[model samples]
Target: MALYNKRINDQLMTNCLALSNELLEKETHSFFPNIMSYWNHILFGDLILLRRLALNHIAGLTPQTLSALPTPKSPQDIYCRKLSDFAHLRSQVDELIIQYCTNLTDENCEQFISYTTTEGESITKVIADLTQHIFNHQAHHRGQLTCVLSQFGVNYGCMDLPIIVSEGSRANA
Candidate 1:
């Protein structure tokens, strides 16, 4: 999971840094107004999930306190962060996520997390499932990002995990 997250983050950072600030801010004809908004949304979601995981008392996954986690003022506030700022924050959150997942045990993954939604709804779900959801969510938005980039004629290259692994192995060899 840590390796998978690292691969995803590496791709995202590479793609984002390749764009100019003006291009990052350009409005995309999609659900998200622009690349920046989509990028920020990904970071915002990760922070929220990490905070929830931290609150679940999962040993190494738990931070000192909930307040220590990054919290957006609101969901919309995420869309307002500058692209560069979001990129920096995303790097930090991605690193923390990799560390948390690396230290997670099977017992910890089997535990359940209980939390209230922003809409005031209560829910309980297995930590392992939630962890997978986090990655799935990132992949969904990354698809959107790639589409948006393509609309602008920006080619991000192969995002497939197998291809990434093969290329990485060749580089190492």
Candidate 2:
């Protein structure tokens, strides 16, 4: 299970970086600013959730998550600055996966995670589902990025699951 999710994590990160690079190459900076803001906001939120999960402190986080997002004045600057942060964010996710995997058993796949969502809703979900959601959410916004890029006459490359794994997302030096 850990291996599977590890793959998902790597793949999601790779595909995001690839698509973001495509945007960069074609000078799609204008299309990037808004989506990148939302993307960074979501990634930062995921990191906060993982931190809570790591410490078993799930409550009282939603407000902090909502309040702590970085605000950028320029969209192009946001893209240039945020990709570095996103790379680190992906590494942090891998660290959490490794730590969680160490404690994982087949019986723990449905381990309950209870937290207050940013929307003020108390939520309980399995770790597996939460993990899936993070990746899915990344893909969702990436699709938004793709749409914007297409409008500017640039094309983002293959984002399919298989392409990510087969191509390998080995740590870039």
The candidate maximizing TM-score is 1
Candidate 1 least-lDDT 10 residues:
72-81
Candidate 1 wrong stretches, greater than 4 Å: 65-69, 166-173
Tally clashes: model 1. 0
Candidate 1 structure quality by residue, lDDT tens digits, 13-130: 7777878888888889897998888877777777777778887767466657445546754555553355666566676677787778777889988999898876778999999988
In model 1, residue pairs whose N, Cα or C atoms come closer than 3 Å (at least 3 residues apart or on different chains), thus clashing, are: none
> What TM value does model 2 have?
0.54
Clashes by residue pair, model 2: none
TM-scores for the candidates: 0.85, 0.54
* RMSD to the hidden true structure, all candidates: 3.4, 8.3
Q: What's the residue-level lDDT of 98 in candidate 1?
A: 73
lDDT of 2: 0.53
Any runs in candidate 2 off by more than 4 Å, and if so which? 1-33, 57-104, 167-173
